[model samples]
Target: MAPVSALSRLPTGAKLFITLSIALLLLALIAIGATLQTGRLADSEVRARLRIAANESARNIAIELSGDINALRVAVAALRGDPADAPSCARAQGVFAQQATIGTRFSIVDRSGRLLCGVPLDTRIPDDRDDPVDVRILNHRGLIVTVAAPGGAPIARVVFPTAFLARLVGSGSRAMPLGTALIDEDHSLELTSIPGQGPLERTETVQTDLGLGGLQLRTSIRSAPITSPFLVALLLPLLMWAAAAGLSWFIVDRLLIRPLRLLRASVAAYTPGEVIDPGKLGPLPAQEIRELGDTFRAISRTVALHEAGLADAVVRQTKLTREVHHRVKNNLQVISSLINFHARGAPSADATAAYASIQRRVDALAVVHRNHFAEMEENRGLNLRSVIGELASNIRATAPEGAGSLHIALDVDPFLVNQDVAVAVAFLVTETIELAMTCDPAAQIRVAVKPGDEEKRAKLRVVSRAFVESETLTHLLSTRYGRVMEGLSRQLRTPLHHDPMTGAYEIAFPVMGRD
Candidate 1:
């Protein structure tokens, strides 16, 4: 046989606990995974917003520079139409002044790098004018644009201060602080100061080219802080998972487990012929459990009622049977009295002997009836020992004058049998003893009842010297007595064995109380 496992031996409550715990653990893991995924998405969104800000800033700066370059082209056209003199420079400066905005200035410079008009800038002009317009950044301080004439000679130049680029980048919002800078990669200079304050906890940076002489726009944002409320949000599902597990377990234990346990205990304590009370279980939580208890209680009540009915029927039957036996016994006694009265007035000895024989057979039946009635109350069958003993005595007492010294020895074992069996045994024993007495008046009869070869069966033996085959005994058995004993033996459902050698008549009888 296989050994029982520890987990299998555990009660329902313990198993439920383990199952709920595993469910909680799985839920916790899923909740944690969701929280982490949410964080990643949030980070991606922050980086996307930063990239958008950088691209926007770069676009705005390019638009501003394009407008200034267009104005520089006008100044260059004015300078190209006249000689390289003070008057022409004056007119070009006048054209430049009309297009200039705050923190911006322009100058017309010759091919030799001579300042002809307007504000002078400490910057070199590229001699190679293959490009019509040239844009430059100077130490992150200002943006310089130079436009060449038709002969590929420098004509005009414009300088916009770094402060002008700062206004274009704009300021950061209170929720998500941003830092913006215009960086000149070639010169390694930051044209605009970053806008924001304090050390950035989580920062995302995006750089976009401004398309003006290696100038690039850098945008950085400080992500929102991870507050207590945010952390609470992340753990909310886990908290809910735990709460749900606890609530579910409580519901199961209260509604299912606990009620079932109580019901089982009540059933275990129930006795036969008793009803199980549903009231002992108190109030149940779920409807199903309540219905189960009600069903069991109803079945118990039904069984108890059935047992009560059967008991009443058995009692009534016993009383009726005993009354019948009592009446039969009275009738037999009356018959015996009538026979005795007739025997006293008999004209011959044989006539009186025939009356005695008839009286003895009637007495045997009466003895069987009396024993059967006595055993009816106990429901156990009649005891052959008592029935046969009383029967033998009655026979000896009512013996004829010829058999006045009749000696009958009883060696019967105590065994029970039904009424039919008792009646047959009584009649057979009476017949055998009388036959032996009639054949030989001084015959010694020994009646023995012993256990048979089979279970719940007994062998009844009547041993006597008179039972041996003889002319006198044969003459007596040739009468109705032989057929009467054969009928009694057939009623017992076994053949009567006559042992000529031992002079014993034996027959097997069924015993009672096999159950």
Candidate 2:
């Protein structure tokens, strides 16, 4: 016999292994392909854009504020008194207009840092009145530059619109592809092109002096997944597939394939006639295969035990049957001998004939019993061939004197029947031969037992040429003797039929063990 490999025994291990291997490989390929094709981060371009935008806006603001301070100095020099009392600070107003600036609010303040004219009286100016140009942010007002007189002390402050800063910051076309934010030195947002609530991937920041003393302009270029649909679509399922395949392989190997291998090993070690100790197998993984192993191990142990005891049980049963048949034969022999002794003391010829007939029937039963023990060692059941052959001899021995020795011939087939049914068949054949004998003392009876109809039934025929006219046998068959033969036929579940022309009595019945 060829040795079985451990892998071959696992019902689905190979298929599952191949399937998982292919799946994981495919997922890896997809991830690799997507990674190779995917675009890289926009950090370099974003940093440059941010730096340029911040620098350009800062430079523009510084130049404009410097120019505004020089112009405001001329206005301060042209005035002789507080501009708050002047109907028109006409010269300063004209200079502001000449700058062609929009959304500019101007205020004149004294050396004391009190707002004097040209703007809201409630406006408070910064205390740094000595500087030529000082940029400051007031609470309600947005961005302002404070300018002192070019020759002296009186100062003028100009506040610019938020749009002015926006135009300068957003001046470059590619400044921020996704978005940009301008943060003040105070960490407050000065301007933004997109919201800041989402997760942000920020590039290198750009900081440039706004010519506003310590206040600097900081620009950061940032983006989010919401800004890139292609990246999201390309990478999401790839990551998911990789994760799923990894998790699936781990679970299938641990819970399914590993346990399957263990089960295969356990089963391969099993031998048919030897009981397997369930304890020899260790705890299996928690899976359906574990339940299957437990069931098979239990069944194998139970079947092995049954196989071990079966031979002994057969020997004991056969011995008991042989012993029972032996005692039955002895008892039948005793009965046959008693009938013979009575035959000798019969008072008349008719009484002697009656005792002899009784003796013949007892002898027939004794022959059946004898055959059962004779074939006991080969004990399956009675072989009909051997049993019928023996009965022909017994019938010839018990024939009455002066009737010339009975000549019986058999044409029998090889078949087996159990003890009880074999006895019935034996008796039926005996009674048949006896009836033929009574019909003709000089008769040669031919008994045939052969397979019929696919071996499911057996046909038995008793024919005698001596009873050609059928006068005596026909009369005997219509009498009480016929009823006894009929009863035997019914017990065998087969009916007897005689053909008048051939002088053959035929019966067909089912045989046990023929199948």
Residue 275 of model 1 has an lDDT of 86
lDDT of 1: 0.80
- Give the C-alpha miss distance for residue 219 in model 2, angstroms: 25
| Candidate 1 residue lDDT tens string, 42-104 | 889988888877777778788877776775666566666654555656665665564466667
Q: Model 2, which residues run further than 4 Å from truth?
A: 1-256, 260-273, 278-318, 374-379, 513-515
Give the C-alpha miss distance for residue 140 in model 1, angstroms: 37
TM-scores of all predicted structures: 0.56, 0.51
TM-score, candidate number 2: 0.51
Quote the lDDT for 373 in model 1: 76
Q: Each model's C-alpha lDDT?
A: 0.80, 0.68
Residue 209 lDDT (model 1) = 81
Error of 1 at 257 (Å): 4.6
